[model samples]
Target chain A: MNFFGIPDIYLVILGLLFLSIIMAIIRVIKGPTAPDRIVGLDTINTIVIVSMIIFGLAAGSVIYVDVAIVYAFLSFISTLFIAKYLEGGEF
Target chain B: MLNQLIDIVIYILLAIGVFFNILAGIGLLRFPDVYTRLHAGTKCTTFGSIFLCGSVILYGLRMWILGNVDGSIWVIHTGIALVAILLTNPTGAHALARAAHRSGVKPVGAVIDELENKPTKKSANKMEAKK
Candidate 1:
């Protein structure tokens, strides 16, 4: 439906989220250490989930909210894995 | 009139959520050390997510009250996601901080090394007992 159906407020929030993602990407690109990148990625993951919820509302779909939940689980697992790797622990 | 009030509340939540999230991004970029970056990156985003998701839940509840079936489902699922975020974010941040410390990514500026000494002392005591 684009902007025709949804309120302008959702659009503005989405724009801000996009900006947040961009800043996190900058950190991911230039982070000096591995943990820094991981931290940035984690931030991006959280913001992405929030945006997904907003997008679901704006676009009039419940599926996006479901997707956001699954994304949250997967990203949490990935963050744990990366942290373990950084810690030099086995498996 | 009630709907208008709800919209106003939603807008306020959105503004606060978006502001903190943007601040998080800035902190991630500007903070010097990994610990400092983690401090900024993890906590602010979690805080922002709470308000953002909360706003959505409120919207969903308002709609559900108006007799929309989809609104009920949205409220439940969004809630699940919010809980997931709350559970995962802090633990992940803790893990990250520990890993950073254990991997020898020292924080910028001078430090007392309290943690450093405690671990080494324990190890030494264990070794001496073994001997």
Candidate 2:
């Protein structure tokens, strides 16, 4: 149960993220509207952020969390830009 | 003894997080319309990620307590990442919903549109004629 005195907790969390990624792919393919696809992508971005943090813990790497932080901001900017494009294509 | 207790809690959190987060993705795919998809996508991911990060933080705290300095740093930093997810995911969803509306994407079977806020060409034509 405990590996190196740290429980194997991160493994379970990572598995969950993987399952979510699989399910979200379905939406990405089946989405009827453009914004629905955008929403799916945004949700995926959030999941990836959390999963990266879990990976960091399991792997004992602080760099993963730092990457997750930077990734979060990047995902936000991309989501906003996409929304703006979908809204009116003008201003 | 204490590590055992933490392990139990972590397992519980992991299970809950996985269930809901995966549900978020499934909902997005199975739902009939844009609004429903947005509802599933936004809520499930946020809720699931909360528990997922929480478990990681707990693991980190355990590592830090056991004198592994890097372990504690990992836990705290992961928490910060979770906070970032919480703040941005919803706002992005809102923006997407607004865009969907403006771009003419309707609900699956919406009976009434209470928010008809687009610029109608009738108003513009009337103004042009008056000018």
In candidate 1, position B107 carries an lDDT of 84
Q: What C-alpha lDDT does candidate 2 achieve relative to the native structure? A: 0.81
lDDT of 2 by residue, B45-124 (tens): 88888887888888888888889887768677877888888889889888998888878887768888887755645556
lDDT of 2 at B10: 82
lDDT by residue for model 1 over A1-91, one digit each (tens)? 3567877778888999999999999999999988899999999999999999999988888999999999999999999998988887457
DockQ of 1: 0.73
What are the per-residue Cα lDDT tens digits for candidate 2 across A31-90? Answer: 766887777788888888878777766676679889999999999999999898877655
* Candidate 1 per-residue C-alpha lDDT over B2-85 given as tens digits, one digit per residue, 9 for 90 to 100: 999999998899899999999999999888999999989888999999999999999999999999887899899999999999
Question: Looking at candidate 2, what is the lDDT of residue B28?
Answer: 76
- Give DockQ for candidates 1 onward, in order: 0.73, 0.69
Model 1 alpha-carbon miss at residue B98, Å: 1.2
lDDT of 1 at B5: 98
| Best candidate according to DockQ | 1
